[model samples]
Target: MNSIIHILQTQGNDILNSIGQHITISLVSLLIAAVIAIPLAIVLMKHKKIAEVILQITSVLQTIPSLALLGILIPIVGIGTVPSVIALVLYAVMPIFQNTYSGLTTIDSNLEEAAEAFGLSRSKKLVKIEIPLAMPMIISGLRIAMVMIIGTATLAALIGAGGLGTYILLGIETNNNALLIIGAVFSAILALIFSALIKGISKLSLKKIGIIFMAVIVLMGGYFGYKTVEKPQVSITIAGKMGSEPEILINMYKDLIENDHPNMKVSIKPNFGGTSFLYKALKSNSIDIYPEFTGTVLESLVKTNKDASHDPKATYNLAKKLLKEQENLDYLKPMKYENGYALVVKKSFAKKYNLKTVSDLIKVENKIHAGFDPDFYQLKDGYPGISKAYNLEFASTKTMESSIRYKAIANNKVNLVDGYTTDPQIEEYDLVALKDNKEFFPPYQGAPLVSEKLITEYPELKATLNKLAGKISVEDMQKMNYQVAVKHEKASKVAHDYLVSHNLLREK
Candidate 1:
């Protein structure tokens, strides 16, 4: 309990920031969706066939997976707040559109007739009679749309839009359960608050609620308007793959870059999907900098075959060459640590089977129970290729979160698991990583991939990034991961402490 409180205290600012982002994104999206939906509903009221087609289209858009939608939007609208809001708006439109159309069309016919008999024009009848009668239903739909947006906005983090989703993703990546709970709880609270507010508005005099809603819209417009005029000296977004090490590295880069270049504003867009996602984002100019692995660049980015030798220099050279020529990305100096996937098993299981190498898997093929992360399971360099290479097959396999695989092995739920070489859990859970005797996996040296355009703009950034090159070792990475994932320390704290200890940052 005390620990949780300490965690909360240390992360108060981040939590607050996330809450603000969540509210802005969701509320702005809701406003935009309502603006589009309400008028469309009115237009459709008289055109039943057209209304059905448009509603069906929106329904289909709503059904697309939020992550997939974000992925699609990233390539089109690019990343950050715009794409995130666009996705939320698409998701929010259906309920509001449907409700508005239903509410307007279902109004008592006698009231419309009476208004017409009183010599009211169609526009007058709509404003004074139909709309007022439909207010309850319209408000209900708005409430539903707002609530749904609040929840769905969490995914905005995936595309680099800061929100409560940042906390949740960071928690999962760093194995910090407390952060997960805090993010989820806060998001739920926000959803409830919005729901209650909407309900209260529903109970108010129509004029009162209308005025309040318009006020909110005006405030949102002003906020965005102000943002457009206020520009930083130099804004750079640092991105990373989803994990403790990448998270730590990117944050450290942000701190160092900002410290070295005080005039520059460094923003973080952490937890890009994987090698492909980061590659595409960097190529598309959606991100400015990120940590990447040489092996990933070799295989995924450069499209090299698996038979490629595990030579660090060769791998780095190829990666550097390809990134420069193809994507206008520069591969900065490599870190000492190698974070390639390791096939691990419980110490007892390894000892019993004398499984010292990946090839040993063939002996226990059908008897093995494997647990793997989604990435490891699906990647060509992961389970599928590894199993085929060695003619080994697991008796049963389950895909789960990367953080839980260690526990899965220790609890005897699985005999084999896939993990990172720098993961602290391997030591904590007494697991042995089988050697890749066949050299199937490539060398995965960590490095920063920076944009050439950014370098042209902020030339000093090269020196700032170079200061971190070759500083972190495999052991250092493992210990840091332990501090965050096992000891439950914050990633930022661990990163800062390491930087200070290494004399990389000036003391306060």
Candidate 2:
């Protein structure tokens, strides 16, 4: 309870910002869904067979997992508010469409016959009689949709849409229960308020409804007008992976760059699913720059086998040249840390099996269970690379979220797990990093990949960001990660502290 209150106190402004963003997304989605669904529903009333097929299709879309839908849309629409609104609009369609169809179809046949007897035209009868009578049911459907949209809008934060869900996802990522509760509770309140507002609107006279809608339009116009007036000179979006180190670096970069150029407004789009998602988002221009590793891009993305070995400079040069010629992306300066993937095992399990390296895992083949993120299983530099190099196989493999793998190993649910060398969880869970005797993995030096177009526009940004080159060592990054992933500190605070300590930022 105290923690919740503290979060509300410290983050009051952020909470309000999220509320406004949530209202905007939900309202816009509901409006779009209504525009399409109502007309489509009317058309369907004329074609029963087609209506059935369309209804089934909408039902299937609703059944597709929300996260899965976001994933599909991210590749096509990239990320941020556009994809989120599109997904929410699809979700909002079913209820409104069904209700409109039901209401129009259930109107009394006798009334229609009476109107026909009175010489009323088809369009006039629909406009004057059918729609007015069905308004109550349609309004009720809108109420239901409003509530569902409000709830689902919270998930938009996962793709960096910036709503109440931002707090929730941040809380989960940082292990802050108070922040999570604040987001969940506020979203519920918004839903309740909107539901009540819809109910009230349904009870209002036609004139009053018109007045309220006009007021909403005015408010929307004013909001947009304010945004246009205050638009920044330069708006830059920097994105990164889901882990602590990437999170910190992105925040640090945002702070330093924005501070250096007061006219520039820097924003972050975190949790871009993974490497593949980030890469696609960059190519599609959904994001400008993101933190990536040279070896990951070289071996996994570029599919290079020229044997750069453990040399960071060689790996970075090759990555830079290939990305420039192939993808039109520039690889920035490399950091001091090498955070490649490591096959980890509980110390006790390693002791029992006499396992010291990837080679030893092969000796115990078919005896141990392996747990890994689905991405790790699919990527070439993941299980495939390790398995082929060491000729190792596990008894059973389970794919799950990367965040939970640490706990799964700690609790003895899985014997071997794929982990990053810089992850604090290995130390927290008392796990051992198995040696890669074959050196199948190459150097993974962290760096930013920027769009060439962005550099052409803001050439100064390259130097501002590169000031961080070779600044953060493995120990510094590991500590920062431990502070966030272990101590539950805010990523921004950790990043800020690091920048200040390094004298990278002018202290305010």
Candidate 3:
């Protein structure tokens, strides 16, 4: 319970900040949408057929998946808030456009005739009569659009647009339920408040726009003041895969430095999804530092065929040598243990069958159930390759999400599952990770990958992480994972305790 409270306290600021970002993105997008949609609606009313065509086009855009749309936009607009805003604005247009059209078209023809009889020109009729009467419906549409945008704006985080969605996505990826709940609750509140305010404004006299304008000004001032007061010097960006252990390690590094090295400001930028994403970010200089496995860099990137050895130290040295000579990058000293994939089964199930290794599993293969991720299953070096190498065939096979596979094994749904060697749950569940007698799986020794520029700028940074070398074994990592994954402990707390226990934090 204390952990829960601490998570809230630590992440409360992030939640609030994300809410502010979410509101800003939604409001800016809505404002742009309103400007474009309202004018289009007014013009289209005169040409009903044209209006129908344009609305149809916009409705189609709304149907496009948000993530796919963002991916399509990335090449043209690049990353950050611009593409996110554009996406949100595009999404918001249908509601605003529909509302404006409905409100304007529904106005009684008698109202137009009354204006004509009063000698009011088209402009005067629209500004004074038509708009005022249609104001309620138009505002109602804006209210709905605002709510929709608020919910959808969460997707903006995927493209590096900072918002409440960042917290929610991270929460889901890391299994941090508190962050998810907080992000959802606050975003909902913001949407409700905005909707209510729009409704209230619609009922107010014209004079109320003045009060609204003043309120916006006051809020902006306070926000700016807070930002200016808390601004830090020497901010550095640490990029890594979202929800990966590297991200957690980076966060630990940040906390250690912030408490010990006060001059440095560290911010985590989780470039989630795939390994290719991190490589691109690193090559493009969008990210300064990240944790990478030596074997991955050596085999995947460098493409060096040095006899396919399983020795991690040799792999690290070879990778470091090639990186320095070729890519002008630095591969730091490797950490204690290699985090590799292990074919595991429940202890009881393994003992019952007397299965001690991959070779042993081949004897009873037809009796076992196997589960793996689709990607892992498809990879040539994955299950198919492993199966051929070991000559094992299972009773049934299924592809599943990486997160779900562990649960499936624990629940006895699958007799064998792909397990990360360093996962703490391996210990908690008393699973038996079979030895690979053939060594089909390659080495995956953990190490920091940094640009030559970073090393030249801050020589101390490399040594900082190297100190954590040999500190975390497979068991240590598993214990940490258990704290967050099963015990429901806050990641920050787990990281903090680990750092303190190791004396990684400088003595104050």
The alpha-carbon RMSD values of the candidates against the true structure, listed in the order shown, are 3.1, 4.3, 4.2
Tens digits of per-residue lDDT for model 3, 253-325: 6776577557887776653434554565566555667788876787677756575467767777888898888
Give per-residue lDDT, candidate 2, residue 376: 92
Question: Clashing residue pairs, candidate 1?
Answer: none
Please tell me which model should have the higher lDDT, number 1 or number 3. 1
**Ranking, lDDT, top scorer first:** 1, 2, 3
TM-score of each: 0.89, 0.81, 0.81
Instruction: Kindly report which residue stretches of model 1 are placed more than 4 angstroms away from their true locations once superposed.
Output: 1-6, 172-177, 226-233, 346-369, 374-380, 383-403, 427-438
Model 1, span 14-120: residue lDDT tens: 77888999999998898899999999999889999999999999999988998877777777777889998999999989999999999999988887788889999
Per-residue CA lDDT of model 2 for 269-367, tens digit only, reads: 765446776777777777888989998787667756586556678889999988998888888998888898889999998999999988998788888
Measured with C-alpha atoms, the lDDT of residue 50 in candidate 3 is 93
Worst 10 residues of 3 by lDDT: 270-279
lDDT of each: 0.84, 0.83, 0.77
Clashes of each: 0, 0, 1
In terms of TM-score, which candidate is stronger, 1 or 3? Answer: 1
| Pairwise TM-score winner, candidates 1 and 2 | 1
Relative to the true structure, candidate 1 reaches a TM of 0.89
